[model samples]
Target: MYATLPSPLGTLYIAASDDAILEVDFRDEAMPPCPPASPLLQAACDQLDAYFHGERQRFDLPLAPRGTPFQQEVWQALQSIPCGEHRSYRDIAALIGNPKAMRAVGMANGRNPVAIIIPCHRVIGAGGKLVGYAGGLERKVWLLQHEAGMADH
Candidate 1:
């Protein structure tokens, strides 16, 4: 199932299975149709809305992003990065017990299927500079500033 909603960033595309969310696309040009009242899609939209409005800090919905095992590990580690906080690619590599795999960690982060709900925006360059995001750098900055209470929209 899928749904689309307008957000501060832009229109967002949300997809889900019966039991878990699959993906959230910020760059998909076409918005796919979804059932009028799919509980899963509605729930995902609600949570994301709340997040953008500063009413939510962590997501509670079930997520089932597809990736290789290594990427899965990186995504899981990303979840541990608290809202309003940031980590370097090196930090993520260390958390996954592959401290030397910073570049690999970055590759996995770049490939994250789910965007904000998975919180990949929390990762930054080692020197605290904003780096690449599947979503544009400006959107990434907005997300970070939003989490940091620095952005009102």
Candidate 2:
């Protein structure tokens, strides 16, 4: 149900249900217990590796991130943000048909269980400023720039 793998950003802890991904935590927190390798975990690891290497711009794994309905809505909106593009919390709130829920949207974004696959790093502050990310601001910047193909800049 879980596995850890090295990435350009850092060690990544990947968790999954029997057929869907559940979480992808950075090394900042206590590592989750590792379970025996499963097909889903291996697929996640492969997709993640391709993403970091710039060979993948989208993920195809089944994901079942546990969260409130609102949070799930926010995560779904995040997926709509095309790779290499960024949006503001306000934009996401509006996209989800709740234009007044910018703050709530931010909170939901913060709690995203799946990381890169859900693409929460694509959300930014009001004026395109890098802001809160569970994976850390630096990693956020790296991810955004990586998607933009400007990682060498």
Candidate 3:
């Protein structure tokens, strides 16, 4: 099922299957009505709300994004990035024990189905430039700033 969640940045498109929350895409304000909710959907919404209110730093909700084994490995790598800290894509590839897979790491980060909750936003460029958010670079900047408490609004 799919749903639209009103968020501080914008309306987010949330999708869920029976086992886990699967997607959270930013909408462009022409979003349709939200689909009916499931337990997983409700849980994701609650967690996102907690994050927006600055009451949650880490998300522990169920996520089941579909992708290749390499992508899954990269997504799991993203989970270990601590709140308020950032890492380079090269750094994540090293953590996953594949220093040469940096390109693949960035691709997986872009392909991440779940957004802020899984925290692909925490990965920066080697020289610290923000890059490659499927949700848009500006929103990516906004999320990083918001989490770091450096955002204006």
Candidate 4:
């Protein structure tokens, strides 16, 4: 099931199965028609709303992002990052016990199906440069700033 909602970045198309969230896409252009939302999708939307409003810092939704094992490891590592903190691609590789796989980690980070919920925006370049967000760099910057503001509370 899926539903779309307006957000700070743009329209968010949230998809889910009966049990877990599948994806959260940033749709600025035309969007395909979405079906009626399932209960899980509604809950995901509510949590996302709380997140964007700075009333919530952490997401508690059950996510079922589809990817390979290595990608899965990278996504799991991404979720471990604190809401207001950032990590380098190299740091994620090291955390996953593949210190030399920074490039591969970058690839996985780029392919993350769920955007903000997975927190892929928290991953930056090795030298602390902002880079590689599927939602575009501007939205990434906004998200980082939003989280930083929330963390101050």
TM-score on alpha carbons, each prediction: 0.92, 0.92, 0.92, 0.95
lDDT of each: 0.89, 0.89, 0.87, 0.92
lDDT of 3 by residue, 1-153 (tens): 887888888998888888788888888868876744787777788878888888788887788988999999999999998877899999999999999999999999999999898899999998998888988989988888888883333
Q: After superposition, how far is residue 83 of candidate 3 from its true place, in Å?
A: 1.3
Candidate 1 lDDT score relative to the true structure: 0.89
* Candidate 3 C-alpha error for residue 87, in Å: 0.5
Candidate 4 residue 11 Cα shift, in angstroms, is: 0.3
What lDDT tens digits, residue by residue, belong to model 2 across residues 1-153?
689978888789998889899999888555655643998999999989888888888899999999999999999999998888999999999999999999999999999999999999999999888899999999998898898893332
Give a tens-digit lDDT track for model 1, residues 7-118. Answer: 8998888888888899998954655545425888888898898999999989998999999999999999999998898999999999999999999999999999999988
User: In terms of TM-score, which candidate is strongest?
Assistant: 4
Which one wins by lDDT: 1 or 4?
A: 4
In model 2, the worst 10-residue window by lDDT is 27-36
Q: How much is 54 displaced in model 1, in angstroms? A: 0.7
Error of 1 at 68 (Å): 0.2
Instruction: At residue 52, give the lDDT of candidate 1.
Output: 92
Off by over 4 Å in 2: 29-36, 150-153
* CA deviation > 4 Å runs, candidate 4: 32-36
